[model samples]
Target: MTHTTLSTAQRDRAAGVLLGLACGDALGAGYEFGAPLPDHTPVRMQGGGGFGWAPGEWTDDTSMAIPLARAAAAGLDLRDETVLDGIVAQWVDWAKTAPDVGVQLRAVLSRTEPTASAVRQVAKAHHDRHGRSAGNGSLMRTAPVALAYLHDPAALAEAARLVSSLTHYEADAGDACVLWCLAIRHAVLEGELDLRIGLPALPADRRALWEGRFAVAETSRPADFARNGWVVEALQGAWSAIVTTPATDATHLRLALDAAVRGGRDTDTVAAIAGGLLGARWGASAVPAEWRRIVHGWPGLTAADLLRLGSSATPDLAHAQAESVDYAYLGDVSTLVRHPHDDGVWLGAAGALDALSAEIDAVVSLCRVGTKQVPTRIRHRVEVRLIDDDDPAKNPNLDVVLLDTVQVVAALRAEGHTVLLHCAQAQSRTPSVAALYAAVHRGVPIDRALAEVIAALPAAAPKRFLRDAVVRLAEANTDSPHQGPNTEGARA
Candidate 1:
């Protein structure tokens, strides 16, 4: 498949696929195999399931998908047998030490040599012997297949089936993968959900069967699919959770995944499945920063790694490292001024990071910096991905990113850690975020906060778009009940 250039929205959605999947996997990890959760019960990544997952840690569902994501990111075709073999080899290595593995996948991997041909033979033999191999295992990790062939629906359908056949020979498993992958592709490209879009690509009989399944899902709730361990029911349960939930805004991504977890049995798999589509439709920007901050698992990967993998999977969307800036050319990089309302928070330019004081244990970076720019001694450091540009397209999740950054700063300060908030210069991004922090956390009016923040930073001049966003955030906060600054709570 040739690389297809993606729009900003398309790029964000493409990166969101794996992120959404991991977030859902971690969220549901603590509830796997449990009965349905009661309505209004708060769903958190508390982490106490059969596998003893750490809070916000993803499970085998994401672990199994990583190799495929890595391959796609490296620009390898998923339909190629050699690439599939490499994926199987990685899975074999992962299974040896994985905290948890699916029963069917374990049966095949444990007994066979780690080769595509050998693994397929063992999988076929297992299916033939028991007449049942349509487990949810294949479908759970099929999200990356969609990213590999987003430009061609026909190739996507073929690759989805071929990849699924590596460990699941059943037609049901392959069909479910094809439909779900096609749906994810559609969501990423078209910004909509349509499970039936790939129906015609399947055999006529199977197409009809899937159509009926979708019907059942649309009319019911995720909890209605009691046998979620099966591939068909897993798809139904995931789709039901998505369609049943009202996606009025980006928060729908979280709500739908929560609904999937509440569907009871095999909570992690179902939620992970739903998350792929939801993330594709909403973009990585739609995912909550709280989840992005903590979600990690398998092979020692973090949320940032997931974002990189997902972006790299789409060759055209591969992120280029930010160009290094000459700190010497920019005037006085050491301008550190205390926040007007909160003395514990210091506002400054990137140069201030050259010699951070011992009192500042936390740092919120608004500009891109080198790997070692932040001191190792700092206990908390959040590198916000806010670009120093006025173009709306440059910062798709401007509002969310801005608020989340302020919240992180406030949370850090509330925990009694002095915080440093800075950008490349003390100009656009830094002062804007600092002012936002004052408005929301310090309970100052938006205009007064901006004026105070400007007065503190002599060179402060926020761009039109960012300044507008601050005003909007302040208005929204004022319209609602004033919650204290630490709304998101301290980071783990």
Candidate 2:
């Protein structure tokens, strides 16, 4: 692979914005309510804090930011209902089982409106019923908006405020979002922190309010900023940590993370806020490698995944393409490519028929995970829900269901039918099932079969969850006789 001419600092800050947020969130997870951490060594992701999250697992802060980052990366207009609807969908889905959710956020998310105006009304209603409406929930997840609009300072400010109104309509919450996003954008684009640049984006009345706050941030301890749920206090705590810590040393990010967690209240959010600025100033590489390896979130995104996502959010790197299918064979088994696996049967995208041979005897569709879509064009159609790892929690019988479909594929091959397994993209689902069939029915070892499958399909990468599921099923039935198939290796 060739490298882009982009500077190392540019790449680092780009990936840093999101990865930093996750690192801080995970690092502070276990210390949310505990005694303040010492400022000597940096905080680690030692799970079992107030939320009982696993080590390196982030919370709602990073989870809620994902859809926004994806939204900005796709260039969706934030003012549009479709864009807001996408954000709402991710929020609702996460809230379904989120271990922690703020009271006002819960009420606002409960309403099924996709418009910013509607969400604002819902938030106002919640505030009327409850006590306070302004919380750090909105600001905690606002860092991605900065990455999404890194080049345009004005647009970035506008988006930061608009997105905040989704659940936090208070002007201070919106102003905090604007200030933090501008700070992140500056750090990402200019490689330094300049909180003053966001002043023009804030409401004229609130300008004086933030000026005094910034002065306090420069000299105060993180504890003086208060780790409460209030948005102003959240920004104060996060910025105090950022400004007080020395950003010059090689371990500047570590010092900042330590300061944010030292307060011991709302540790995750405060650290997350500080992480964004620190990451923006330093770059993703500034975060400790040990912490990066373990940091993950509800979106199934590890720090590495988030780094890739953040880098992709850069405007010069963004591109749009129509879906195309590539054809290859996993040993004797044929493969068709898509996003998720297609149960090792021949399936093509809507316009990828050119690459796929029109002479296919059968097709198995495993797109959409749980919902099986039976094919009508092919003579023999096998439906299998070989879902990705993300869906396993929702569908517990995924392994058994996949095993049954593998047997069915073996049976079809024995009956002398050439087949193609396809999913939405054939990237993970289709290739995984193809490799599994090679291992189980064709007597190939799992590793060798996987190597062959990926080698044959250069575009395909292994999906560990699907592969493990298939391997577990294969190991369970290893002692049983192979009675379904007719050949030593069934050719698809």
Candidate 3:
């Protein structure tokens, strides 16, 4: 428990990265419409318009990022119907409001653009029509794809190129997507800032290896220093800034903000994408909290919840869901451990499915304000919750819907005798309620039971995200705390 390499405090602090990215995103979002910033705050909005978005509201940038991640997490292949469907569905959500999506993207999404297939249709179209297009827009939202395919650089390139063509049909745009995806892949997985590794020098022959390519955008000229209108310039700018910056944790992030604020037509999006890449390099933790507190993602997707959710859900990944081992941190401890809850270690895909299903079942049951699970065989359902100290009426979205839980649990119980108990992470909060349930049904001691869990997972089981969630669970109960000698009182 007292490992010298990382203290509990350090572990908790490192867990802040994911939160950091969302904050940066939300904070920067304030200026997305080219809004003016008060002198006190940094200016991230510039150019023709302001983001007009409220704090925490992400634009097409972050929204598009998740499904790509989902697709990648599911498989490296963007061609997979599941992956493509996921991507198109997210885009469709955006099109619902801002229907005037970028040209190529709109066509692909509509499936009216004469695409031969999903894999390289967009890119090929650009090659055929635009002569050569390399737009930074393709690069901006490339992180999720990079993250999903962190293990496969070439695959990352292909996917990035494909998605890029959805909006941009030029080779430069395609290359921009490939290069930026490469950059983000390095940033997120390799903790790299330099473009030299996977993204070769621009206007170079790197594209020939994948497929014969040329950067023929009129906007790009060797002497023009590609800027404002050229995707290559923005892509290269991000690369240069990320690589050459002072290495201050958020330095690259700041530069990205700089890009968006003054970045003219595509300012905000470019800023968002650049910040994402930079944030990934900094492990998402380096983003400022002020910003993350404000950055908003949609109901099912967002920076705020994704990584944290990932922390727990990661352990529950189905076999087919994992891509590569990437990196594992025993939290703040310097030593590395095999990543648990990953598809890699689970004897391939089948083991993953079994584990994921089990984990989801545990989550569904354990965190229920209410839940539904068809418990096969003898089924035990446990629900634990802590009421908000301030208000009983207010509900955090994370809690399960009460009616749904009741319906499922009721039906299951009707099928057979069901074992169900609800407890908070802290025994005290859950105790009174648990005691009530115990009187009515089978129940276990709340306080004493969780203590054993803590002891068992002193190093291994309670990953940081899971541990924090437990703390929150205990917090909701507010009846007892996890610190000190009293931990064993419940005989747990």
Candidate 2 per-residue lDDT, tens place, 447-484, comes to: 55555565555346546676567566666666433233
Give the C-alpha miss distance for residue 274 in model 3, angstroms. Answer: 1.4
lDDT of each: 0.86, 0.69, 0.42
Question: Candidate 3's residue-wise lDDT over 1-492, tens digit each?
Answer: 011122222222222223333443444444443433322244532212253565456655556555555554444467455556556666666655652244445544555323324524655565567665555555555665555454567666777776766656676777666666676556544455545455453345654542221233222222123353467665543444344445553344554455344433444454555565665555433443334323556554443345433222122223212332221221321221111211111111111222233322221122222111223331233222223232322222112222223233334344443223222232223223222222222232334434443332223222223333344454444454445334552332
Quote the lDDT for 460 in model 1: 80
Of 1 and 2, the candidate ahead on TM-score is: 1
lDDT of 2: 0.69
Q: What TM-score does candidate 3 get on C-alpha atoms?
A: 0.51
Residues 196-220 of candidate 1: C-alpha lDDT, one tens digit per residue: 9999889987777888889999999
Query: Would you give me the overall lDDT of model 3?
Result: 0.42
Q: Is candidate 2 or candidate 3 better by lDDT?
A: 2
Which portions of model 2 miss their true places by more than 4 Å? 1-8, 113-117, 318-492
Over the full model, what C-alpha lDDT does candidate 1 score relative to the true structure?
A: 0.86
For each candidate, what TM-score against the reference? 0.90, 0.63, 0.51
RMSD of each candidate relative to the true structure = 4.9, 14.2, 15.2
